[model samples]
Target: MNFATRPNFEAISSAPVMQRARGTARIGTKQRDGKTCIDTLFQEGCGKIRLPRTHSSALEAVFINTAGGITGGDHLRWGADIAPEGRLVITTQACERSYRSTGDTAHVEADINVGADAHLDWLPQETILFEASKLDRRLTIRLDEGATLTAIEAVLLGRDAMGEEARDAQFSDTWRIFRGDRLIHAEATRLTGDGSERDGLSLLRGCRAFASILHVAPSADRAEQLLDRVRALHPAAGLIAASANGERLVIRAMARTGLALRKLLVPTLIELTGAGSLPRLWHL
Candidate 1:
């Protein structure tokens, strides 16, 4: 058969390559009428971000992933910049879902910048991982000397109410923060295993929900108070701990259900901060 007349073997060999989704979002603030205003926004591909109408003085941003969920080979990136003396809170429109993977791992990265005297709350919602999902995510933040950062992240191994369990999974998440080029926090959590493994149980004592809250430019008294509160409250049925390392305060919580974890985290943070205020979109 003539090469031209027949099927192009080389082209056919590559014709079925999976086309993964890619997205990027950028948000920035500016001074408007002597107040911090979100004046710059960008969205590309499947990622979109917008400022919601909020009664509070602080700027509120909500990120939307139009593709609905992430799977293997997908990539998403987000960046936010807060002007000097500005206050901003960032969150997702809903929980991010990671589906089962059949190929390469999904990737996500976030970059945040807070100017001098600025305050930022990086409070994105939880991420849910289904069985066999593969993912890697990283967050980097740069804060000016006087800036303050409050960030929270959570992960769920599957929906307990849905009767779904994630046993076969691979995930890694890392965070790095710097204040004026001086590193304040650098940490990573990695897990990988088959459908059944005793070692996985040791990772969390078989807990399905895990979360971490970190405050930079630290709060020792509040951290200690909250730690005592959590320990006093949940003497059993879950795990909660807190520690301070120099200028960073870290709190970690794990539970049998994702809701249980959130219940423990939200109230403690609010009680510590003296603000019942959370991301406007948060439910329970």
Candidate 2:
């Protein structure tokens, strides 16, 4: 098979056990045999990364850095610099689980810089917090005038099938959005034992799974209206949504079970953004 010529970032590490054995390409993309590799280092481990360049269409990429099923601490940092006139999409292979942070809180930092007229989608799978685990995340995104971006963040409590509850867990996340050189949105959420019982009602509402999807576009009003329709479709306690500055749409959802919340959000996102279903890794 002939492969297109494109530039790829250099690989600096790998995990012998977690690495991808071979390479495969999906529809409408190029293939790089063994380009995806997973490696763990002394303080951190690197997961698979796919950076494919499409000539007639938008470029696409994926980065994996951690996992709970592998019995190792998980930490990941990824960023995409979409040159002007470039477009790209990103996703992961599975949900990241921050097991008990015996050493320090599991950390992840994502930075995205979308050039003028460029588009970027920073969509990864969900992240689960296990008993006594702690996570601190910071997402910083910058877009040039006329650039567009969509980002999704999902979180789950203790592993349900394992019967592990979040009674003793701690998690915190902070998100910041900027356009050009101004701050447009900033949010922070923390879950700890002290206020779990009280704040849970206002946030989790007895649900073990929660997710937020933010889509920013010039027609934010239309997006918000679309979110309103979705909220109206879901049961009152299952989902919620809100509008922002007529160009950004933020939707939040909670469910007694993980599957329940996903079922509610997937259709809404597909309808609103015209994007495909989330990656298979999120279900785990």
Best by TM-score: 1
Q: Which model scores highest in lDDT? A: 1
**Each prediction's TM-score versus the true structure:** 0.88, 0.73
Q: How well does model 1 score by local distance difference test?
A: 0.82
Candidates' lDDT values, in order?
0.82, 0.63
Q: Model 1, residue 102: displacement in angstroms?
A: 1.5
lDDT of 2 by residue, 42-61 (tens): 22245446553433255546
Writing each residue's lDDT as its tens digit, candidate 1 over 1-284 gives 65656767998898678879899999999767756798789999999987887776678889889999999999999999989888888899999999999878999999999998888888889999998999999999999967877888899998889977687778899999998888878999877855433135656777788998887753446546555664565446557777766667788888888888888788655543312378767875
